[model samples]
Target: MKKFDILALGELNVDLLLNRIAGFPEVGKEIFAQDMTLTLGSSTAIFAANAATLGARVSFVGMIGKDSFGEVVRSTLEQRHVDTSNLIEVDNAATGLTAILNYDNDRANVTYPGAMSLMGVKDIRPEIIREAKHVHVSSIFLQETLHKEIFEIVRMVKDCGATLSMDVQFDPEEKWEFDYRKILPLVDVFMPNEQELMAITRKATVEEAVDVILPYANVTVVKMGTRGSLVISGGKRFHMPAMLNKSVVDAIGAGDSFDAGFISAYVRGKDLAECQRLGNLAGAVNTTAAGGTGAFSSIEAVKEAAQRYFGQTIEL
Candidate 1:
């Protein structure tokens, strides 16, 4: 038997969130913030943690440093019941981190790639790939080495006889230079938000972007925030409306949560619509708590949020 159902091959980082700031940052001015929090962060970390919470046998393969921040990342994923056996620690680089300045609903972020950027396809071994039935990779743009060797990374998973999923989280540089025609055909699931879909495809509208990818894409899932998600498979479209939380706390990791929900179900052989429903609920639940993982402490917690808020039970 495989050691895990899902292997999260992605970036790891810590988040330093500053809330209730006195004023916006200026050229060289000092600012004070009333609230501060330090927690595990990164789209991949959120997906791995929440997937484990939803009862998936999940493992993480990412790079960290020999610093205290790295310890926090390791300990946090372990606390979430995510296997960290494949996490690589390097002596030269510090762990990645993002400083988030929060306003009411939106936030400004400054990221330090650090050690995460150093991990490339060479860091992943065939043995590790064989240990999982599915491999998930995210935040392609943030890691320079991974970005440069993405085609090889996806191909490696396929050659190892494992399915692959990718969430190309926003490209900060706005270059959107990924070779989708060559890459999408190899990916089992292509998960991207609406804006990301347009940006990556170099199209002005979602419809046009989807058209661009249709020929080469397999199963494409588009995250349309607030409106829920749209799934395309075998040229058929499935739309799931958002089950909005009555009282939303924050939306820090909702999309990642969506990925967690969908993949958790997908690996268990759930249908497209069922996967989309759970994904929507997971995303809405994520917003009911602080950060990306607050609402997903346990499977019971996730199910409770689904029932209490959306009046739906998450069987998976």
Candidate 2:
């Protein structure tokens, strides 16, 4: 058996969230009326933290600067019990960071790739992959220089007999025009939100988009936000409803938390329906707080919520 349940590789950063007031400010005009909060973010970091909190022995592999932000990331992961032994510190590059502005549930984010982009395929250690039951790749485009190397690493994980998963983070600046045709076949599970799926397949409907991308992987899960998620595998489709919550504070990183929940359920050999249910619970729980990972819940809490709302145990 593998020593670790999941090994996550990708970006890590601190997020500064700014709440912008309604009405855009006039060009060249200064307007100050709103609020802000500093938070931790980065797709891979959040997912790994959630997975570790959910009782998966997870390891995070990525690069960070030898700066205060890097220290914060390290401390946050340690507090969450995520393995950071494989994390590398880059000497010259600064740590990655993002500034997000939100208004009435909508948001605009400005990101700095920094040291996160410095992660290379050479940075991955084979021994880590060998010990992990599953390998997850997040924010592939941020490290544009490492696309081929990341694909190679995924292939190596397959060769080592571990399941592989990937989160497609679409950046308009860095368009995802890669040959997913070649890389998708190597993945066991492929996860993307509705918008990302639409962009990748150029399809109008979610079902159509799934049909177009299904051939590339054994299983495809498309997160549909409030409507929950759609899971397709072996030509069958299953829909899970989102857990109802009174209020939602933040939606960022909810998908990553869903990924962690789904993968954790998968590693436990849960059925497809159960996986989606747990995923929805995880996503819903995350929105109860203000930041990306602020509301990440434990496996016990997730299960209790599942039983309370869905009238089902988390068991497969």
In model 1, the clashing pairs are: none
Please, what's the RMSD in Å of model 2?
2.6
Task: Compose the digit string of candidate 2's lDDT tens values, residues 1-316.
Answer: 7888999988888888777655655678876647877657888888998888788899888888999999988988888889989889999899899977676767777888889877776787788888899989988877754564767877788988889888887755645565667788998888888888887777888878877777776888889999999888898888888886667777878899899889888888888887887788888877776555676656676567556655656553
TM-scores for every candidate against the unseen true structure? 0.97, 0.89
Q: How do the residues 1-316 of candidate 1 rate in per-residue lDDT, one tens digit apiece?
A: 8889999999999999999998799998998999998999999999999999999999999999999999999999999999999999999899999999988767899999899999988999999999899999999999999999999999999999999999999999999889999999999999999999999888999889999999999999999989999999998888888997767887889999999999999999898898888889889999989889999988888888788888989886
Clash list (residue pairs), candidate 2 = none
Please report the TM-score between candidate 2 and the true structure: 0.89
User: Candidate 1, overall lDDT?
Assistant: 0.93
Q: What CA RMSD would you report for each candidate?
A: 1.2, 2.6
In model 1, the Cα lDDT at residue 150 comes to 97
Off by over 4 Å in 1: none
TM-score of model number 1:
0.97
Model 2 local distance difference test score: 0.81
